[model samples]
Target: MQIKVDAEGDDAAAHDLYYWLRQDRELRRHAKADLTQAAEASDRMNAGEIINMFVSNGLAAASLLVNIVVAWRAARPSPQGTVTFDRDGTTVTVHDTSEETLRRVVDLLASAPPGGASGATDTGESSASSGSGNR
Candidate 1:
């Protein structure tokens, strides 16, 4: 999958690793346990070390999440906007493509000349109308 990590910038390998971790129940359980242990250990460790460890672990987790999201996005065709999937029951949700963007894109396409491409269409549609109207 063509995963695009914002910080890592196209870290497909890292994304695959995270996907594997998520799919494998054993690995997921182990990772959860490890995170918990590390969090607990942070309290007993020196202040500097604890802070460093906490930050590092948090960043790692965040990076993993970014990669997974990118991978999931790539897996789907025509993902309208930011998409999320639930591991249980295979539910998917899309967000982040604000009504403004949707309206602008729709207006852009609608204003195009027959058999011609246009790029200068105005995009000032109101959110209430754009969102409430059926496409």
Candidate 2:
């Protein structure tokens, strides 16, 4: 399974995430993670660096989703923007670091089939939505 992480115009933030994942011993052992630059021939709209990760062994990609959030929260300035996690066609965006947002996303990803993304929202789970909520 492949998980594409885009910082959504935040290349610096993406680079930070790419390196953060690289620094993880467990992630390195279980998956093939690489940083990608926009193809030279690609159009402007698609231009930017994205991290492409391929899951091969023991890692549950969904569970590791928290790592991205963790990394974002660890940022010194903490990006005032969002990061997008795209799997197949289902995209779950992390808007801000909030417990409600975190749980909602965890539930959404966990409920889906392995290697699949189900864009479902839990009405009972309240999010800051200031930067959280389904996009």
Candidate 3:
């Protein structure tokens, strides 16, 4: 997956925020665990056998359901624009689109709090990240 962040604020603050996100150990650990589990699950799926007609139909149905769910999520409407962060009474919204920025945002959000944001919150703007299975 990829992450994209855009911030409207001081260059130094944005860079520092990104750095802090990268150094967060919990985020890194969770991201590693998630990737590992996905890899393991992918490895365990064995698609070589079609035991009988019923089994084949069941597999096909399951695949269809999975595809449908993915499609539904893709079609769902989500908030658009940059994630806003409030630091020391200053509101900073992230909008960076660089590869490194994406990686950092992904890693940070992977293990962020349920709200997808942390730290200062006073601007009433959401500086949240998006992900699941985070601790």
- Model with the higher TM-score, candidate 1 or 2: 2
Clashes of each: 0, 0, 10
Question: Which regions of candidate 2 are displaced past 4 Å?
Answer: 1-10, 39-47, 56-61, 107-135
lDDT per prediction? 0.30, 0.53, 0.29
Give TM-scores for every candidate, taking all chains together and pairing residue i with residue i: 0.25, 0.59, 0.22
Summarize candidate 1's per-residue lDDT along 31-124 as a digit string, tens digits.
3311111233221221211101111123334344434344454564442232222221222232333455333323322232323422233323
Instruction: Tell me which residue pairs clash in candidate 2.
Output: none
RMSD to native for every prediction?
18.6, 6.6, 21.2
Residue 97 miss distance in model 2 (angstroms):
2.1
Superior by lDDT: candidate 2 or candidate 3: 2
lDDT of 2 by residue, 64-116 (tens): 65665556555636334555555444455556666766665555444543344
Instruction: Give model 3's TM-score versus the native structure.
Output: 0.22
Task: For model 1, name the residue pairs that clash.
Answer: none
